[model samples]
Target: MAETNLQVLLRRRPKGAPVPEDFEIVETPVPVPAEGEVLVRHQYLSLDPYMRGRMSEAKSYAKPVALGSVMEGRTAGVVVASKAPGFAPGDSVAGGFGWQRFSCVTPAGLIKVDPQEAPLSANLGVLGMPGLTAWVGLEDIGQPKAGETVVVSAASGAVGQVVGQIAKIRGCKVIGIAGGPEKCRFVEEELGFDACIDHRGDLNAQLDKACPEGIDVYWENVGGPVQAAVFPRLRDFARMVMCGVIAQYNVVEGADSFGGPPGPYLGAVVRKRLRIQGFIVSDHGWPRYPQFRREMLGWMADGRMSWREDVVEGLRNAPEAFIGLLQGRNFGKLVVKID
Candidate 1:
């Protein structure tokens, strides 16, 4: 174990898009675990669009990270020391330890991960939260059925990829809305999505061609122009799972960012009898966890499911990586590898 732990702290709030100056990297002595606590050494930190919301002081489902405090994120790490049951030194675990190289916290919330089952970092991604986010949202709210047309925005992203792939597994015709052609190709060829449209191009034209039958299930992730394009294409009785709006995460509150106003979609919703529900991954039903694990794990082991990650080295570069993520620069799940 190292004598010190390097941490990334929120130096100041950003006005629009985040800059490196908004974060300050500092080193502190490694903390020791107290009774019932375990010491963790983070190997990889998960970066998602949701972190942008946590950077602001605005009221939300979760509390904002306090100024001068470590930024919030889930981490996959190895235990350095433990004073808690069900954990021991060298045990691999995943937990909400925020942005830091090492941490000491109560083991109550720690999730034990078997490295033999999957790569350690995957616990922060596909085999974990991102996968669960896709599973619960699509299964619970979207309720897609065979031969239905499902469109997933941010198609190549952490959550979007899983949503599209799962919809495919359920026999749905999956159309992915990705940023670039490269991502679109991967979404179609690699993930088995039926079709993929580049959101940067003319989404309306491409979406019209891709889903000629109209969208039955819309997984709304990049909620901006993409949402606007998708609205007019929704079929009657369509279901929309309101996920993250990455396109507007950086925009200053109260100003038009990327999406259109609610006024435009109101009449369409009532006329079409559409069902729209917003959800957070944390609010996923506990009853479905076992099913998610059994099915997703089995799918991965049998080569029916796959995943990708865009790894950025060093904890200090997290801010830049996160900024790139919001711009749709990352082709897959984004994570910071801290040494």
Candidate 2:
């Protein structure tokens, strides 16, 4: 076992988009497990858009990452030492282990995973939180019906890919909005979205062409001009599943600038009788997780769903990779492979 634990700490809050200097990487002694605690050695760390919100002091659903503390993140790992029952060395697990190579956690904090069922890294992606987020948001909120148009923004991303595929399964005409031609191609040709518009292009015109019938359900992931374009296209009685807004995450201004004022859309909401509900996945809890896992695994087995990961080679590169993710440079779910 390595003697030292490598960690990425929040050095300072970013005024806007996060930079490398905002994080501090340091080596410290690997933590020892106490009674009822297990020491885990992380293999892969998940980087997500929500972490950007955590990096700021602004109020949100969750607390901010304290200064000088390890940056908050989820990881898939193996147990190296255990003082907890039902957990032994070599057992695969997934949990909020932050951006560190090792963590000492209680059994309740970890979910044991089977390598035979899926790749250990997958527990942090498609079959994990991202998958759950997509499932809950689309099923509970979007409530898509067959032949209805379902549009997903950030279509090539971790949650968006799953959202579009599931919408397809539910018999919706799924259109995706992604950045660049390559990502749009992956969303359409690979993931089977009906069509994908490149946000870098004329978003409004392309959306008009793709969603000519007007959007019945809009799964929002990017909330800037993309949201603006989709908002005006929502059909009567349409449902809008409000998820993340990556485009606004880096705004240096106050919270009012986050989603750009909803005032203009208020008249449309009442006129169209639209349903817009923002959600955080953890709010739904683990009760529905078994249902999500069962349906998602079945979809994967039947070849109805697919996923991709943009993996960074080492822990040291996470900050750069994460910055690239926010800039839309990553083509898929971004994860850091710890070495």
Candidate 3:
């Protein structure tokens, strides 16, 4: 076992988009578990868009990362030492281990992951938080019905990919809005979305042509021009599941800068009788987790669901990979493999 632990600390809060200099990497002694705590040696760390929001001082659903502290993240790893009951060394687990190579956590803070069910990295993606977020947003909020037209922005991303696939299985005609042609093609052919619009093109026109019947369920992920394009097309009584607004995440300016103002859409919201609700997946709590895990695993086993990952090797490359994620450069779920 290594004598030291490598950790990424939030050296500086980002002003707009994050830069490499905003983070600092340092080494320290490996943490020793206390009573009822287990020491974890992380193998893979999940990089997500939500982390950007946490890096800022702005008030959000979650607290901001304190400067000079370890950057927050979810990780999948093996237990190296344990003082907790029912947890033993060599067991695979997933928890909020942050941007570090090792962590000490309690049983409540971590859950065992079965490699036989799926790859260990999957615990941080499709079968994990992102996947659960997709399910809850669509099923609970969107309430998509068979033959309904469902549209998801950022469709090739971690959460968006799962949303689209699940919508398809629910018998909805899924249309995806992605960045490039390659991602659009993958959404259409590989993930089996009904149609995909490349946002770089004429978005309004493409969306109109693809969703001729008007959208019944709109999963909001990117919330700038994409939100503008989709909002006007929602059918009467349409359900809009507000997930994340990655397009506006790095906007240093106020919310008004992103898609102009929400004033223009408020009238339509009332006129269309739209059901728009924003949610933080964690609010749903543990009661629904088993259902999510069971259903997702079954989908994987039946070959109805699939996912992709963009992996960056070494903990040191996390900042670079994360920058790419915010820029829409990553092709799929971005993860860092600790070296």
Candidate 4:
């Protein structure tokens, strides 16, 4: 048996915001699993905007973490010990194992993975939640037609990047909205988007310049200014997939993160018979994991898709990196290497 040193809860119920001091690190004797359980040593920890909701005491998609509980996160790791029949000592798995160096997991929540095919870290990025989010949100909700104009916000980040590239593969004209000129260049030159507009620039003017035919499908990522800019240009009978609203995540109530008053453009949804749907990407009650894996893997193998990761070196940096992600500080998928 190996000794486990872990990061554990110090306190909960964060004030207006969270800081690193809110977390406490402690070491305790590794507990042995009684039955039907496995012990895993974490290799990579996923830090997402959704975690911010967990830090606060709020009703959300899931229950809030209790005080003195391990911080919740999804991780890819190696199984060090197992009492389960099928899982062995050396199997690799991904699960909601939280922000710790090691975790005791039940087979119910763990997913077996093969690292030999793709990089194991991909289990947390393009091949994981982000990938699935892009796939289903675009396919089922957006329903992008060939030759249609597709717009994606946060266009260089994990989800938006894949969404744009996949839209391009489907023969749609892909326009990406991202912060800064460098990210815009990466989206256009490297990712093969038809056009890339820098949101940090004059957004309305730039989008107007890029989207002459109007937006047929809008993949919403950052919701504040970008959404405002894109809304006016939506074509008749357009579709919108509301994904993440990272720009407004930190805004408190009455702060007007949506900018001034609502624009006159939303009336187009009713006038033009548009379709707009918000989704939370957990297969939307359709466990299409098998189909998603097949199509995405095929695209990856054929180089029809690409992915990037903003890998933070340690867990200590997760807070700042996550803050940066909200501000569009990260250029790709953000993850913490915690092994």
Which residue pairs does candidate 2 place in steric collision?
Answer: none
- Sorted by TM-score (best first), the order is 3, 2, 1, 4
**If scored against the real structure, what TM-score would every candidate get?**
0.97, 0.97, 0.97, 0.93
Q: Candidate 3 local accuracy as lDDT?
A: 0.92
Model 3 spans with C-alpha error above 4 angstroms: 253-255
**Model 2 C-alpha lDDT per residue in residues 1-339, reported as the tens digit of each score:** 758999999999998889999999999999999999999999999999999999998888899999999999999999999999999999999999899999899988699988988888888889999999999888789999999999999999999999999999999999999999999999999999999999989988898899888999999998988888889999999999999889988889565464546787998889999999999999984679888888888998899999999989999999999999899989888899998
Model 3 TM: 0.97
Each prediction's whole-model lDDT (CA): 0.89, 0.92, 0.92, 0.82
- In angstroms, the error of model 1 at 193 is 0.7
Error of 2 at 329 (Å): 1.1
> Model 2 segments beyond 4 Å from truth?
255-261
Model 4 lDDT per residue over 32-138, tens place: 77598998888898878777777776556778877788888889989898998789988999988887887787898788989886887888888888888999898
Candidate 1 residues 134-203, lDDT tens each? 9999878999999999999998989988998889889999999998889989998999998899988988
Write the residue-wise lDDT of candidate 3 on 88-178 in tens digits. 9999999887999998999996889898999999999998899999998887899999899999999999999999999999999999999
Clashes of 4: 0
